[model samples]
Target: MAKGAAKGPTVASLKKVTPENLASLGVERLAELLVSVAETRPDLKRRLRMELAANQGPEHLAAEIDKRLGSLQTSRGHVVWRQKPAFVRDLDALRRLIAERLTELDPAAALDRLWLFLQTAQPVARRFRDRDRDGAVAAAYVRAAADLGRLLADQDPHLAANALIDAVAADPEPWAVWAPETLRESSAAMAAVALKAARGRLGGAAPSLAVVRALAQAAGDLDALRGSWSLQALANPSVAAALAPQFLAAGRVGEAGEILRAAAPQPTGPSGRLPPPDFAWESAWIDYLDQAGETAAAQDVRWASFERTLDVDRARSFTTRLADFDDVEAEGRAFAYAAAHTDFERGLGFLMAWPALAEAARMIAARPDDLDIDPAQAELWAAQLRRRFPAAAHRLLRAAAAAAFRRREFKLCDRLTEEADTIIL
Candidate 1:
């Protein structure tokens, strides 16, 4: 009240104006602040307008949403990489407004608008998805798709099923992946409707097989799922491998075996004789043999896969299944096989990961020139082996340093050389 007294800090300057603090400023002041803030922040302004529309009732909110959705639908501007962040943020905000806010007031309108948004957004999303290394834009669409699924989950099963059928039938890419969860929450009758609709879309380039398999799995109708796969489809090793597990789980070992056996290897290479090995089919067959009580056959498949592929997982699976002393013997054989493997790098990697450090050391000493050591892997190996296999660790670190030096990475090379020096015997 004194004229010469220093003025106290105003309320805006006294503390950070968080939501709680801003609320204390009272509705009138807050409204003015919002308007001032909205003058510069378009996103916040649009959100406030939507909230205001919502106050007028669902119809008014629905009209605002329709205008927004129509604008998005007509948007033709390509969202370049630099524009992606704002594009994703705005799209996600619209998705949340429809899903979280509008749905509560008018569920049917929300669902319809969401479908419209998805249909409008998917093509643009798919265009950018390939170039989206971090997948921010694609993730926004996934969240939208998942929101659609959750909304469908709340609808009556019959109506929800029809909505799902129509969604996938229109654009199946991202939607089909989320449909199974909705289908899972639906009644068997709903699942049947979904499966039947998917069946009609089969071989029509709609990724309908995925939908069929997903629906059948949800409905527990393995028969329809099996019949859904045409012979052409079954010939693809992955398809056969996929169907085999369901049959095996049902104790139809013969059918499982028959399908796996019927699966043709995907031909590759100049001669076409060297078909890329179907590791999935091999694993499936091992599983089928094991479940059928053919332990010996399963073990043979496991060992063969290990030998042919040098896949350490198959080696582990084989050795784990062997009886006490037999495992030790099998492991010895595996070690020898790895040491003599045609792919020197793979063989050495196998030995190193197996913690056969002595063997790895011997391999390094024997074929140092053949080893292509990753610097990080070499660092880990050196740290692990320095106390015991100093010579091998020295060799690995020097090799990695040499690799780095050749690539003109002087800093990494110097760092590695220093590390290697500490291991000199």
Candidate 2:
């Protein structure tokens, strides 16, 4: 069965949606139907029409959920959940609001409110049905039946982010009997999250590809593992430096070089007493880098950034997030070493890995075709790898150039031929 689908026979069928008893849908299509009902909930929708007929505040309903939930403050403060009140008070208000509205409004709005309220009142939702199979909610599972169909139809990256994967992987109930696409979509979601995580590490965001892939695979949604808004939002020049090594490990040498070049200072003197990267920015960067396979470099940055965030005297577990690199049993621990106990010499050594770091000004200007294993990128990585081993960039450059020339377009051939002197063998 698809991820996120509810298990067992249909609790009840909708008016027009039942096709030989909607149970025939494989996990994927069943999930689509489930998500569809979640968005509109026909029974609830008809009820909502009655409320609109009687003139309930569409605008009032639309009002930002402030007074009920209270103020929210964070980096991404505008995300709607900001208005959520404290657990007890929020649940009380939700019950009161639903009761008052039920007297006049239709079922859909009331249900929508109930859904949103359920999301907010997690405890109540859990009590009602704690299907925390994969760290997701039951509403999400039901919503999946309604949401997946539309999501598949839209095929947009934004809406179908984490919930679908959670539904399939986390389902405690036997929803497999009802939906197959739920599992299929969950697979897609895993891949999506993986791509996103890869993009983040390579692009100077957080190193979460491993996490997404690990979690999504367990949930049966490899394709869905492609995006992470939190990680993407944190990217910048400073963050890139911290993200460099992970990018290299993940087959994104160009992105890694780009971040390091921007963040690390130009070397001075033999040992290199470089200017410190901004502590605030470097702290987060170090956290991500530590997870990206450059442990020595990560430790080095950790020392510098920790000095910035903590007092000179305090000492505890130097950690940020508890990351899972591979599988749970064969994985790195969650305690991604925080900057608090990081050492400076290790950080410095990591910086030394990149010798001629000035080459990354190219990726930002690169287009899709220019994206094949680039020669310019090869040279930069070659400089670093050959330093520790006998690695060379010449062969990689030749292969990329050859591949570029193989394309039907004459323009690409001309371009590679033109830049050969500056970048390749």
Candidate 3:
């Protein structure tokens, strides 16, 4: 407070060094500083040349970017992982030049340059095959390829659709990037072309099916999509199951049911047990039955699914549809069925998941021969049950710890044993 005391610098006296702040240093001084820095940093030197070219006009900028892209395309030195970050950053900078700056000045010219930029992907990719194990280089090229869609957006749809398809058909590795939704909105002719290309590339393969499905859905001709699936394709349960929901959405309920029935495993030998259930196929069939208003049939499937698989979702679906008192009765029956399932761990898991802790406790207390608990799930289930049924929780923890010991997981065994002791205490 003394009159002679010096005042400390105030907040306003300090200046952050930003472009605006640095401008006070004036152009000549800043230019000298950049020249000195550029002498040591080639990347910064290249960037400076780019900025200078851009200031001259977009044509100049386009020329500068093309030169760099050409240099990258022809080069083939292996880039180790340590150099990948800088390499990817340089590619990204070129992408921004083509996508953001050059496009604003001359769109047609930018479109040509963008295509050239994408051509560098393959060469750039080869340089890092063993190096970029994390896919950084490929991902950078994918981003650059995406700009083709934006550039083609305002062009004629027929030409645009064909150009896009041809580009993909030529280098189908980046097929997904070229799949613009706008092409789907094109005429049925374009959809037909896409379907043909899809079918031609790899017959009945999943990727081809994806292309056909997208085009057919857009054109409202799901039958064409279905027809693309060969008899061989339908023989794969997963392929048949994949098409069921699309048919359901189109209200082709009978066709949906027919395909699923045809795909279901045929009655085998004397047992007639069929192979282990394909749950994905079962779920699709249940959906189809529900859509067809086959309530009683659906209920049978749901209950059967629960009994065979001890699936909690199936049990809930089966019991939830019964009349009020009927639901309570069916629930008890389902619980009893689950308790008796052949797979003891699965049965116990179903009870615990249903939080029917009392039943779960009783089941654990019985100590079935297959009493081992899954080590991963044991800690969580034990935590939930410990307060309500300490003895049951302790039993599960001890069983899990014993299993861990058998697996030579000594640390886990010790941890679980300590947890079991705490549960009983």
Candidate 4:
């Protein structure tokens, strides 16, 4: 008398069938099946087209690319929100195809076409309402530029240098902010190639210094690489931060340290609030110090930064260093300090993430009776603690439920009351 399970196989189960069986059908039936499958799965059709295009020569592929590009261009007037992603995907596929063909046959032509694609497609991307799609198109353009730069780097270094320079100079405001990490990385790669070409041209007595100067000139800054617009476009912390590794690589560790120290943010005002530290620059300095066997200095910076900010990540990192040096007492103190000063939920998370459960329990128990904690979060934490420390969990839930009741958070109070009862039972 039980109700029957849903009839028919799921699409996932249907996918388990072998393609060999489908091939056994006559050509007419196979064609019919292909139509059905293509209707159901558009991505399959796209993949098949890409595979066919890959097998064709550059001339044929170029024609196909033109056709796809034309379709996208002409469809701009009538594009709906739902159809925008499809159009962007089609354009991306065509651009990639064009780049591949042109790179293989003519690197110079590839660079020209990619530059044109960036100019044309970026406007179209900007028009789309979906920010993610715009970012995707932007990333594709940057990647294509990188590919073109690599292609032209060896064949015609000047052209490659110009192409890369043009790419970095392109306006990257909204897209860069939306997708800074990837866009910054792609821009950096292009800049690196341009710098390499400049270095090749400016071989001198002090090759490293000359190369840095040449990089400055190529960036259109006659002064030096420091504070160049081109270097700013690369989104590194500062010119000194960017150049430190290059100096270190050239066996100038002392110069690298000087550069980093000069760039380091100074403490400000009587409150001793330092300027918001550039994490990347700080990390680089710490790494360089560690590499130079200045373990104590590195640890000192790490601990000071953590104490000033109560930043959980810095605390963890400092703890890791302490553990490496077999300093368990310092590590425990670090965790205790973080737990004491950090916000209740964040402190709980930091302690739990560190798997310092005993410390977490102690911190919760020691919290002032009048202090407010989010009732829902307290209940959740109590649930997590019940498995390991039942007594502490029960006390926490009861306290949170009382706080919730006092605040007229009846729903949370009821939930916590039930949870506390369950734990006690």
Choose the strongest candidate by lDDT: 1
* lDDT tens digits by residue: candidate 4, 233-312: 33445666666776566566776786777777777999878787787787778877976889889988888877766667
Candidate of highest TM-score: 1
Q: Which has the better lDDT: candidate 1, or candidate 3?
A: 1
For all predicted structures, in order, the TM-scores are 0.80, 0.23, 0.76, 0.67
lDDT by residue (109-202, candidate 1, tens digit) is 8989888877766556544634678877667666776677677766776687777877787767665566665555456666776677666654
Q: In angstroms, give how far residue 279 of model 2 lies from its true place.
A: 4.7
Off by over 4 Å in 4: 1-28, 33-57, 71-78, 99-116, 126-134, 146-156, 162-193, 196-251, 267-281, 291-294, 316-326, 339-347, 368-371, 375-380, 399-409
**lDDT, residue 355, model 1:** 68
What stretches of model 2 exceed 4 Å from their correct place? Answer: 1-150, 153-258, 265-276, 279-297, 311-425
lDDT of 2 by residue, 216-238 (tens): 44344322332322344324444
Total backbone collisions, model 4: 0
**lDDT of all the models against the reference?**
0.80, 0.40, 0.77, 0.62
Error of 4 at 385 (Å): 2.3
In model 3, the runs with Cα more than 4 Å from the true position are 1-57, 89-114, 131-133, 141-147, 150-153, 176-213, 269-273, 406-408
What local lDDT score does residue 224 receive in model 3, on the 0 to 100 scale? 82
TM-score of 1: 0.80
**Residue 371 local lDDT, model 1:** 65
User: Relative to the unseen true structure, what is the C-alpha lDDT of residue 389 in candidate 4, on a scale of 0 to 100?
Assistant: 79
Model 4 steric clash pairs: none
Model 1, position 94, has a per-residue lDDT of 84
